[model samples]
Target: MSEVQQARPTLLYVDDEDMARKYFARAVGSEYEVLLAASAEEAIATLATDGARIAVLVTDFRMPGRDGGELLREVAQLYPQIVRILVTAYADKDMLLQTVNSGEVFRILEKPLSVAQVREVLRLAGERHRERALRQHRLMAIDETLAFLAHELNTPLAAIANFARGIESRVAGEYTEQRQGEIGQAASAMHDNAQYCLAVLSSFLQSVRNSAGSKAARPEPGAEVSAGALVASLLDTYPFSGDQRQWVQVEMHGDFPVQTLPNCVALVLSSVMSNALRALAGTPSPALRFVVVAQPHLEIHISDNGPGIPPEVMERLLVDPVTTHASAGGSGLGMIFCNRVMQSFGGGIRIASASGAGTTVTLDFPSFKNRMIRSDR
Candidate 1:
């Protein structure tokens, strides 16, 4: 084996015939650490002792006592991360169909396997194994980073907020009318900005907690929420300046009440609004219309007359992080986060857009009646 292949995990090759097993191992032994087993029973014994170190399993379809199909089923249930491949000399249509339906086998190899063919299959299998490992590693790293940031940033943020409030109070009582007017404006602005920063920080911390597998902070159970009131409050506190605030118009069609985690709902809506604002930047007479319809279920439609999402971006927008404006510090996590939040509440989000036309994001929530019953229980 080459030095690089020696560092990789062992690949097990199983067959009922000793000659077949030796021949198969000889073909691939130079490129991989090959372990040979004469039957399914022996293969199971080898796996029991060294399954964790086995990267791939190749077994013959026909075997005495236990078959390859049964062995693959057992391996799939126990070591699902391990890559499995089946090799057969005979063509049994029904057996092939059964194996495919079980979904345990990654790839099926016909009998008379060539060195080149087995080498290529093993290469693909190794790639899949490495990709799965990388994805899991990244997810763990993200969770750890989020937890550390939430813990480290919470105390300093609180201290800053308190100091800003203290300055505002002192400026109010310790100055004359003229002096107070000058200093109070600055103090008030500091306090307002601090509060906004704290709000955003809190939202992000909650998201971190959720990602770390803890239940998100929510309102009291059975507490009724007014959809219109919530929307109005979010808009009023949203950081909008000058005519930009006036560009957003809200229309309420009917009264909608729901029982859910208010903070989670707010986070989802805030993310949507933030994305809309970013999209509308630098557009002429940029307009945003928020329409709430509340009959069968509550639906919020956020429409913007800005350059719509590009076709390439829209394709993997929700599936993966595809950013259009990375220079502007877009992380491409807004829509993905919103989708997760909606899924937590058994709700969903849909987006529609074209090249020149505007974009529309629709958030759908469960009916109040259904949610109320769930909350009550």
Candidate 2:
């Protein structure tokens, strides 16, 4: 294909009527490479094959099998990057409002769809798609930089602390014993400070990667650790502010092994826990609960008693995310990255919240058939 052909963004138009499909394909073929599907099923199949090339999905709402609203919902959940538009002949105000809000659709085009309207909608959608692509590229670049910083600083920092210990040990003698002991304590403090700094850096960097990383490679399943141990490690390592540690209550219903890297799990938990903590801020009698369950499948529930998420904002967390605190440099990538991690591990994450009721985030791990029970060490 020529550069011009490749430059033109692709748009998928779904309609049950044959004439309508042809009309749309003919109408907007000049600006966008139009792909047509007869029904929701055919549209899904086309996306399965050509989704990477497609930027916009425009569908006729009334159809035989699955309606356009249903397809839009599915696409929003699965391929969130693709922009969605609903073209309906009969627009029920309530239904349209609900569908558009829930799906985070780009636009709603009423039937008798004019060529001008279609062109304008596609133009806007194309612009949005391009902007998102650029933003995603930038986020990935930032993540690469963070990774490099972490890699370069970690080893040398550890070596410096180790060398400090040796220096403290070598200066020990009868005259210098007291001085050497004080020096040794200083070395220990240095090590602790360095380690603490590294831990905080890792947590902050990991949080960004969790939200910004669009395409992180899946690592092979690593060694397993007990849920209790994992949770304890997370809570222990997490840097809590004065009196914030007192707010958390950890409970273990049952213990089971989780087959995933501890760091990956910790990062995922950190993102959600960060969100919960932000919500809990300034709330009276703020409470944070971390619970583990080892039943049909291992589950970690992080619940906070705070002002709950709004309906529109909660819906967008997975479908179309935007951080509640943009002024505070929130990227709104938390749930998206978390969901990707869960999917990578053949598991899933569930977020349940209401307006007045607090939010609960549940990380659901897939079950493994080979089960081993280990006595506590």
Candidate 3:
């Protein structure tokens, strides 16, 4: 390997002045791998070369063609990990200030620059670049894992739900009353749990796909949706019977108000409520409650008065990549998906519960812009 490859770090210097470029190369060459480019175009071309690690960019404010400010803007947008530094003369004070205000350049070194001062700035900039690269790598890894795991898990989960529904129907229709009840209950429970898993898996998959590439398709900017109506529609279509409804008391609190960004908010709320409904078993006073507070943000709080998240499993509920620490009934994908959905829409969820104090998950999505909405009778 060349000495530059095994050296401390590499600095890319872009300037039109051959004398200044030679001077800079000599000043910093011993301590660093100085890649000299006479113009912004050459700097970009050099940056594109394979295995060319340009930690810090030092470019003159005034170049023959594209100036440092213009070149740094493109670099920041494209390879944001590379730190940008503008070198300006005493005459270019106005241009330097303009570049700084535009947030294009990280720092500006005026002419008559000392070697030691330039070295210090380059050191700091290189460190910042490395930190940013690390963060980007981590985010990329998370997105990839989300896609693979969610897609792989969805197939088996769908099959389990289908078979459970089939068994439930056969038992309920053909089996003896005594045995049918037991078999029917088991199948129903399995189907509900599987459906819950599917919802969680699908939500995560959607969020990852959305974040990985283009922006998520936003719903129409302005549309009033009745929260109450949305809830009623889903409840009517959801495959649940009167007996199941009787087993759990479902309460929709507050005079429901119309909210903007309604679809995204509603989908998250419904998923959380559905998960709560599934967890409403093997506990006294099995009930799922929804309390919608319309304020700064459209707040939807769903709570279940079940055994609540156990101390051992509560922390792992939504934090882990795959949370299997939930109750033995359903897959823990529900909370994971819910959290990701909240985060994607510039929203988030807050968890509140003690060991027996029934878990409450609150979702807060952006509210309607400058529009006052009243509850419809």
Q: Estimate each model's TM-score.
A: 0.44, 0.58, 0.52
Q: Estimate candidate 1's alpha-carbon lDDT, on a 0 to 1 scale.
A: 0.73
Tens digit of lDDT per residue, candidate 1, span 287-328? 999899886668888999989999999988887987775644
CA RMSD per model (angstroms): 13.8, 13.8, 11.8
Best-performing candidate as measured by lDDT: 2
Better of 2 and 3 by TM-score: 2
TM-score of 1: 0.44
Order the numbered candidates by lDDT, best leading. Answer: 2, 1, 3
Best candidate according to TM-score:
2
Better of 1 and 2 by TM-score: 2
The C-alpha lDDT values of all candidates are: 0.73, 0.74, 0.66
- TM-score of candidate 2 relative to the true fold: 0.58
lDDT tens per residue, model 3, 140-214: 676677568768988998899999989977886577899998888788778777776576555545544433442
Alpha-carbon runs more than 4 Å astray in model 3: 1-8, 50-52, 91-98, 144-152, 175-196, 199-377
Candidate 3: Cα lDDT at 371 = 23
Tens digit per residue, CA lDDT, model 2, 240-358: 65577788889988876654444466667777776777678789999999999877668999999999988888888886767776544466776898888777768788889988799
